[model samples]
Target: MYQAFYGLREMPFSLTPNTEFMVRLPGHQECLNLLLVALEQGEGFIKISGEVGTGKTLLCRALLNSLDAERFQLAYVPNPCLTPEGLRRAVARELRLVEADSLGEIALLEAINQKLIELAHAGRSCVLLIDEAQALPDDTLEALRLLTNLETERSKLLQVVLFGQPELDDVLGQERFRQLRQRITFSYRLKQLEGEQIERYLNHRLSVAGYNGPALFERAALRLLAQGTRGVPRLINIVAHKALMVGFGKGQRRIPRSFVQRALDDTEGVQGPANAQPRWPWGVAAGLVVALTLWQAPALLNWLQPWLPTVANAEQGGGDESGQ
Candidate 1:
């Protein structure tokens, strides 16, 4: 609703994992680089885990777009919430094994193996990318490990990359999963964006969405946003979009901290670094947080001195208009 008024071609903060809105956050870029290198080295199992909304899926898609299609036959199974047999057929469908849906569990396994080998022989490698893999059934996960066991004398024929939440780590840490855990040759954990990174993230998204106006979020607004969302991009986007709506509804051009706080208050289940600060403490002190942190101590002291009737510059005729 606010797009045209704000000079944006689209809602920059939409929660969809649009690759076009992707920003080169350091953590994400590093994860992507490691994934490329690991896949190139023929690692059998690679894992990427992070808290909810930390961009695991976005990074997964970025990796997909980065890979050269001719050299790699890519199969994506989003949320593998299926039984072992179902999981096998899901993967087979992605790998283009049309007959897999009708095959028995054992036969499906063989077909998947043959498909991987077929791709390997054609000067191409096969990769299975599963999103939200923490939800994969125990038996299905074991099936995945079995699939990776198919290999030539040189390297494995299939490579698997799992993108999931932090619980995946917990699930894999179980003693029963020792073998599967051990086989994860490479893994990377995604971190939430830091304060400074959030500013760039917002700006990049805005720019990509065709925002040519002045800065959309004011400094204090940005600070509160960083704190309130604790730098999680999805939360940041949700809160930001709401803040813009708050601004637009009020016919305000720029977003302020109060607008962000309103957004935070209206939203629920926000693991809320977002607790609404009370009137006394926040009204009296929160506004100074940015200035205190941003200014050098000496400069801040110097700036304060001019307002104080202290001796450092008292004799320089500084405090009063009439030097009284």
Candidate 2:
């Protein structure tokens, strides 16, 4: 809504993992580099853990996009909350192997192994990525570990990467999963962006959306964003979009602290002493401005367009009209 008013070509704060908007902050870029190195080394089990909104999904998408398809056959399972048999079938579907819900566990294993062998003979690496893997049941997690056993003499034919919240570490710590946990040759903990990185992140996103302005957000506004959102990119997006609406609502030339404060209140899950503050009257003014701008921008632009030519003609003192 504030895109045109702010001179941005698109919404800069959307939650979708558009790799095009990816800003290579230090932590994220390091994680990406490590993942590539591990994959290239043919590591059998790799894991990445992060808080819920710390861009794990985005990183996962980035990894998938970066992989060379000619050398690696990719199998991605987005949801891993399934029984052992169900998990096998999910992996099978990803590999485009025949669906074998009717086959028992042993038969399913044989089929998957045979398929891996076939891929190896063709000189392709089979790689599996499982997201939200903390939800995988013990049996299913063990099944995944066993799947990694599909190997040849040259190098392990199968490689797997698991992305999940920190609960995955708790799951891996269980004695039953000790073997799988030990097999993870590479792992990284994703951290949220810090103060300066947050500023760069917002600017990068806006620039990607074709925004070229004197900086729209003031220092106080950015400080509030870092305080209230705690540097989580998702939270930053939510607060920043609302703050833009707040700025547009108030007819403010630049985003101020009040805009971000109103956004803090608007957030559903983040109300606490850290963010809670007495409502300011300018917050309401901003909303009114937003409403008025929405109601007036179209009519105002339309009324201005036709008059441009008439104004130019009048300025030129048209010979016919002036009767010179």
Candidate 3:
């Protein structure tokens, strides 16, 4: 709603995993590098674990985008809540096996194996990326193991990368999954953005979204964002988006730290304490601003028409009025 007011070309804090908005923070960059190295080395299995909203899916998509189309035949399974039979068919279908739908389990496996071999012969590496893999059934995981059994003397025919929450580690630690666990040639744990890094992350995304004005967030606002959001990208996006709306509603160009505090207070499941005082009053103040704007909008617009572009844009019916 505040895109025009802020001069943003697009929403900067969207939860969607757009590679365009991706920031190469240290943890994510290191994880990307390790995945590249592991794949180049033809590692059969790789695992990446992170907390919820720590950008696991984004990283998975980023890795998918980074691989060369000519050298990589990619099979991405976003949901792994399939049975053993279901998984084999999924892999087969990803390999473009027309027989997958009609074939029985054994034939499906053979078709997948043959397809992997063909890709290898044509000098293409097959990569299967499984997202939300912590939900994978026990039997289906064994199916994945058996699929990895297909290999030439040089390297495994298909490389598998698992992106999942930290629960994935506990699942892998089970004695029943020991054999499969041993096959993971590479693994990395993704950490949340550090408090100091939140500033850079926010600015980086804003710049990407075509924000070229002076720094939009004040230091206090940045500090509040860093503390209240706990450095989780998802949480940061939510709070920052709301804070921007708060600023817009108050007709402020720079985000007030009070606004971020209000955003955090309004957010559920966020862990930060109410470190910033006077929260209720600021919320009331923002409400009063909105209320006052509606009450005296015409006179306010007439008075500020020459000084404020925001009011001028509103007069032109150009200001964003969409809901939060």
How accurate locally, in lDDT, is each candidate?
0.85, 0.85, 0.87
What candidate 2 gets wrong by more than 4 Å, as runs, is 99-104, 271-274, 277-324
CA displacement after TM-score superposition, residue 291 of candidate 1 (Å): 33
lDDT by residue for model 2 (1-324), tens: 778888888999999999999999999999999998889888899999998889998999999999999888899889898887887888777778765666788888888888888988897888899888888888889988887888888889789999999999999998888788789999999987898999999999999998998888899989888988878889988888888887877667598887778888777545455356547545534695657768898887787998889888887887666786
Between candidates 1 and 2, name the one with more favorable TM-score: 2
Tens-place lDDT per residue, model 1, 103-128, is 88788888888888888889888889
Tell me how far the alpha carbon of residue 13 in candidate 3 is from the true structure, in angstroms, after superposition: 0.4
TM-score of 2: 0.85
lDDT of 3 by residue, 1-324 (tens): 678888889999999999998899999999999999999889999999999999999999999999998999999999899998998888888889988999977778888888999999999999999999999998899889988999999989999999999898998899998999999989999988886689899999999988998888889988878877778999999888878878877878788788788888777657747543445645634743794689799999888778797657776674355531
For model 1, what is the error of residue 74's alpha carbon versus the real structure, in angstroms, after optimal superposition? 0.7
**TM-score, per-candidate, Cα-based:** 0.83, 0.85, 0.86
lDDT of model number 2: 0.85
- Name the best candidate (by lDDT): 3
Once fitted onto the true fold, the runs of candidate 3 whose alpha carbons sit more than 4 angstroms away are: 275-324
Q: Name the weakest run of 10 consecutive residues (lDDT summed) in model 2.
A: 277-286
Best of the two (1, 3) by TM-score: 3
Q: What lDDT score goes with residue 198 in model 2?
A: 92
Better of 2 and 3 by lDDT: 3
Question: How close is each model in CA RMSD to the real structure?
Answer: 14.4, 10.4, 9.3
Question: Model 3 clash tally?
Answer: 0
